[model samples]
Target: MPTPDTRRALFARGTWPEASRIAAVLRLETVGGALLLVATALALVWANLPGGTYEEVRELHLGPAALGLDLSLEHWAADGLLAIFFFIAGLELKREFVAGDLRDPRAAALPIAAAVGGMAVPALIYVAVVSASPSAPAGAATGWAIPTATDIAFALGVLAVVGSHLPSALRTFLLTLAVVDDLLAITVIAVFYTSDLAPVPLLLALVPLALFTLAVQRRVRTWWVLLPLALLTWGLVHASGIHATVAGVLLGLVVPVVRSQAAGGPDAGPGLAEHFEHRWRPLSAGFAVPVFALLSAGVVIGGAAGLADALSDPVALGVIAGLVVGKPVGILATTFVLAKLTRAELDPSLRWVDVAGVAVLAGMGFTVSLLIGSLAFGQGTPAAEHVTLGVLLGSTAAALLAGVLLLHRNKVYRAIEAEELVDEDEDGIPDVYQR
Candidate 1:
């Protein structure tokens, strides 16, 4: 048997959170997901109403203009508040790379492949559909990346409702794939979406970033020291012509994931990353994301004719195809090919059909998709409006389809669960009779 020290060391590896922490985070995200839906609905309704109040609220400029940061309310939500969400994403990415499933090549291979394929196929499908359509705008091709993201909160919330009896491994698979998807989406934002190379601010950003890294590595826990430094880094990054959210990810990654010597041995409770995630996750999910959703998801769907025009638009069709069709095809194909080549078998409780359902669920790209749509085509533009409609329609279709398939799967799993729960006696036998 393993000793207590060994158990402590094992826990210290930080590959995953304690079950309770995961549960807490999931519950919080579920609530956030519901709020996200509410925000999106309100935005849609408010925007489509007769008055122009929604546009005024979204477009109102309020930030300090002197520093060249006077962005509109929507821009602030997209560029400013979204940074908090990215920061939490960065923390999760660091944890996964340092101690989670990604650290294990064997364990991470399938999901990593799935995430890549999922992203790639969607972009290709979008590009193909938009480029081939004569009605597509000149710059419509840039929005190919919009459907490449998978909204974790939204997808998981749907799963919780429709697949309550899904095998535990299926949920793990979805979570891992979504995490990797977020990482890829972040990379896309940094690389493909950046404009105008401002070398000075970009280079200057490193100073604060490096200092932030040093403080966190040395176990400096003071908020005053870190907060200003973080803000400075964000400002420099924003000024550098790079999206400000990249700074959040960089700052998160630099935070030391392992326990320091000052924090006792490996078993001396959670590390700084875990502590920070717990403290910030609620803020990110509850405030940053919902606010962003409210500000971004509101598109004036022009009545029945307008809705028809949007759905028929080449850009919208491309987004719909990319998300609803491409995401699942890419994920399922990649998983199947990799499993065949590697001779790896899935958990006995999971079938390829279950994976397929999860893949379909992954197509529900909401948060990051909307953000990318705004970036690809400036918000409130006709192209942007079409992209918004596509994301909403595509995600809804995927959710409804996945719900049907998963509900059927859930019934099967429930039957199995019932059988497994029959062992009521201490002897591990069904006490069906007094015999």
Candidate 2:
């Protein structure tokens, strides 16, 4: 261990910046997760209350009407604020692809496969359920992708709380899987959800995107220059009928992950990508996401009968089944099959049960699911409301189930940790033998 002064100097020089950055992200996400829960709860209560205040607030529109941007408060939150969250996600994705575990094919294979399985299974299940149900709406098929996403912040937050004693590898696996899940979700939003695509604005978006990429490539870290470019690109993308959040992801991808000579030499510090992530992650997690949740999660549960009706709706039932059942079944089944095929065992510290618990945790599809639900059925419509109810109910169930399972897993991990410590003290004698 270093002396206090040495530690201070190292910190000042950013010697352990990666560890610091990771810790900062984890802390912010945990708090954000808690805030998200609060916002969702508040929305639920406010919407369910006697007053119609929630709908009024959510429907309040403010923006330039001339540019066709006079969107409601809910749209602004979903489309505008969520871009920031996606930007941070894009940065994380780029970092992972460039320098993190995802850079290696061997390390990436399992999570990528699991993510694919996780997405595909839920979608298939949703489509099958919706199609089989005669009561399903005409366009219920579009909502099939709603439950395909895994909320990274919420999932990690739950893991942090319930699996504090679990191996770091488990968290790593979850993060990787979530990242891939987000990528697929983004792609689906871009390809399937876009309507009335204006080619001109879409092409115009390339200009700002290119300039942004060039600036970052040249080590230009000026906020004024980059922010305008990002906004402009987002505007163009928004106008082009694709989801505007995709612009954030593209902007993030363009940023160079590796440091250049202009960025204070090879050993100078973290790259621009890392710097941007550190600066924006707090904004994304603490503000953008929570605000989005407050806006989007407010659904009028009507009453017990209303909730029952929503749950009984085929679309709602499909989302619930997709997230709570299909998600885990797909993820766990894929992992097990891959392990068997490759003859690759899990890490010694982990078990199949732990993976199952995590798979269940992955089913907490809140943010992206809500977004997709809105895109599938017009926001504030009865169908959309039912989708929201399904998402809330499904995600809540997943969280509670995962919490119980992972909490027990955490206890087991703690006991194993104690056994290892005891073994170390007993000259390598096994804990069972010593006992």
Candidate 3:
């Protein structure tokens, strides 16, 4: 290991603990992504059936109306179940910024810049396409945020499937980039999307949020103490009309990432955030997101004509263009500019082509894309349906394109691996490590 005076290289493998944690998170996300796909497929089939049964089920209302809790099943899926997804996102974000590779400003710079560019270019491209298209919906501009998100689970799942030989650094880069992207998406939702916001409920939401924060900070792990406060906070935020998912992020932000002194000091061991992430990630990934997908992805395609019409719609076209073209362009351009400005270089073992492949993979926007689409165009509107199709098509195109590129690169890495193995057989150490 290098002396304390020597700085570790950017995108180095990181600590063993960090690597292990990343691997675990990727495994969870990979499985979650598979479930998300299955749910989407099921929803599509249910939606296209002759009876309109899926729509009726989605429209069915439940819960207590006294607290504005009674809502269509679709609304609950969007507003409530997704809070769990966002909560996990929040936990991951805080952990990264606080104790992960992102705590180093030098390491954080590239991914932060790339995430901003990824979001900006997509939004701009969407606006441009919508503005230029005559057949765009009246409020299509609102959906500019649709392609700004990178679904961590879907992208990670695709990578896990295709990139066995890929370098660990590339995976780290993608994870950091996507986490930052999620932060931006959450900001857009809270600031640009909120309407009819109620100050009383919004202010009142702080009470439970604070209590929950305190509980986590004190290392209170009991489910009974924490779960009710979390639910109440979510409910009040929903009442305030600031998307309930925002509450999840807020709650996540407040959870302490470092261990308290009584627990053996800051670096003694994993803190509550990690513990909470471990507990809730399964619920979010396995049940919450797939259920949301079941409820939201059920857009009835009226055969070939309907498919043609959706693809023709300017809104849909914009979303597809944004994901397939704008995302990679933005990420690559930003990374290039940042490297030039800082006079920094990628890790010695990696190449610009490797970065290129990950940039393209960043285009796979799914979960938050669909969420923003629904919020932009009212749920169940024709525009919303078009948005769903665009997201589906755009994400699929990105996945296919990225897969081809990464698979080619994977073969190159595999050859490198073979060479290293040969060297190891001769000297009991890989040539690169021997260097």
Determine which window of 10 residues in candidate 1 has minimal summed lDDT. 426-435
Candidate lDDT values, in order: 0.87, 0.89, 0.88
lDDT of 1 by residue, 129-194 (tens): 988889888988999899999998899888988877888888878888999999999899989999
Tens-digit lDDT track of model 3 for 1-435:
776434334223445566556546634757888999999999999999998899999999999999899999999999999998899889889999999868988888888898999999999999999999887768889999999999998998889888899888888889999999999999999999999999999999999999998888777878899999999999999999899999999888888898665556644566889878876787788788999999999897899999998989999999999999999999999989999999566655567888888888999998999999999998999999999999999999999999999999999888877866435556565444411
- Which segments of candidate 2 are over 4 A away from where they belong? 1-27, 260-267, 343-345, 421-435
TM for candidate 2 is: 0.90
Task: Estimate the TM-score of every prediction.
Answer: 0.89, 0.90, 0.90
CA error at residue 48 for candidate 1, angstroms: 1.3
Higher-TM-score candidate of 1 and 3: 3
* Span of 10 residues, lowest total lDDT, candidate 2: 426-435
Ranking of candidates on lDDT, top first? 2, 3, 1
C-alpha root-mean-square deviation, each candidate: 7.5, 5.5, 8.5
